[model samples]
Target: MSENILDIKDLRTSFFVEGNEIKAVDGVTFQVPKGKTLGIVGESGSGKSISALSVLQLIDDPGKIVGGSIRFKDEELTTAKTSRMRNIRGNEISMIFQEPMTSLNPVYTIGQQLREAYKIHQGLGKKEGTKRSIEMLELVGIPSPEKRVDQYPYELSGGMRQRVMIAMALACKPELLIADEPTTALDVTIQAQILELIKNLQEEIGMSVVMITHDLGVVAETCDYVAVMYCGKVVEFADVETLFENPRHPYTVGLLSSLPRHDIDQDELVPIKGNVPAPDEMPSGCRFAPRCPHASAICSELPELETQEDGNDVRCWIYTEQWDGEKGVKVYDNETTS
Candidate 1:
């Protein structure tokens, strides 16, 4: 049996918006091993968050899992009932959302929220659960945790609130944690601190993590593997070092190039040429063809992700001998990988 904690295959999440069906996660496949972090990188509409939510079957009304299999701890989560899902959600797979303010109930004190969360999974008495919550707060680096536990979310700084959120997520000591843009709302220093806190906690608890973010820098600093998403599909999948050093998919290249570089010339930021395509109106062909610097005639016909010799997977015709971005050439008569 594999040591992986999470495995998703051909997962597709959709939503009903304006009387039309929209595909948020289209055939996403990946695995997260115990004690490892898999960074899912993409723009806002690339379906990274929805994919994570699908694993826990948290897609609310109007949004649904239309197709796929989600496996956690070798158990299939795709068809699991709500009661079964409840057991997995906090106890086996906790989530740290992007915004801390909305996640925590403002009506409750910090201690009350944490105690309730811990008690649900631990089945411990209120006193023991409260004690565990305070210990977790301290473990996450909150100063004078005993005192801080009595404070409200508004009393804490942005960084501190984020830490509390992390602590709450870890209170259950889950086997998997899905962090969706946990640091995007904070400043750089706070972002660093949160990332460090997550890394340290991951090491201590040995839980597999799914880190979803648009920032490539975060993925580079913390993740072991990367899945670069574009228009609801994973366009590039590779090991961290390989993806960073040798990204082949045009969308992945665009993302990496757009980052501001002090070492490079100010004019050299290679921003992605187009915004994310609308869900319903996604192009019939390659979704990123319009923006891809390497796009060609064959790109108008769509491209399938092709596996390469180096274990890097790319979904561009340029790499698959169908089109050449440079010199405007088309080599293949008709080629597709399904």
Candidate 2:
């Protein structure tokens, strides 16, 4: 096993909307191993993005990380000072957001934005910063980096702008890279290129990555470990291969069943029933109980994440001693489980 670069325990982030405290990330715990990628897979509103933000201490006013600890390289981040956190953000941990068009400053040239990280963190002068900025763009596979650095974000195409975001994020050689839906806005071909770029860069720099995405295909292609989250909590945590092979949680099963596979011939896609529960309207017991096909009376009580004999952790009553071995949870696409 690799050493962990980030360890989060019982993280709970919430937002105050309309005088109601809504839990966006509730009791989430996971670890990203050094030089490896951990994918947090969940549907929209599953708190995947918020969990990543909480790690960087970027939760704004009205949205707070109410509880839990975030330890980055054994340093506690939840209590870190603003100045210290700022230093940590671009220097040690950088994030590539979903939309480069919005994340990149339209008013500034690409070179200016990229150089900011170097100037602040590394104290590079204008000439040296510009040289380094062009190098980064080239490193991320942006053709004609010399010309591109002088251009504004609007002058670039969507894929090129996204590449710029990656260049900026990696300018400081951060130890951890948090990419939240990095390929969400790109076309299929561009998405593949972006994903490959991130993977190659990760291997080159030896940095740990926390990939927040709803696409299972992306998870399979890039992740070493996987965390399946639902209704703001982690329902399943396992190695990527184990997760796709032997998913134990109902929500995980549902997500796998919903994937559109070219190898498998399916007449209809099987989507998970019901939408993610609203934070204020969370159910009394297991958050997924309402939509779980196998939910029983015992499901009225929340289940803890329990480690199975195979070492995967799953949060479901079906795997516990109280299950009595008779109750069945209908997991789809489960033809190969041992």
The prediction achieving the highest TM-score against the true structure is 2
lDDT of candidates 1 onward, in order: 0.80, 0.86
lDDT of 1 by residue, 251-316 (tens): 776676676422224445556676887775688889887676566778788777778898777777
Write one digit per residue (lDDT tens) for candidate 2, span 143-248: 8999998999989999889888987887777899999988777677767777787787788989889998877878888999999998899999999989887788
Give TM per candidate. Answer: 0.87, 0.90
Error of 1 at 315 (Å): 1.5
TM-score, candidate number 1 = 0.87
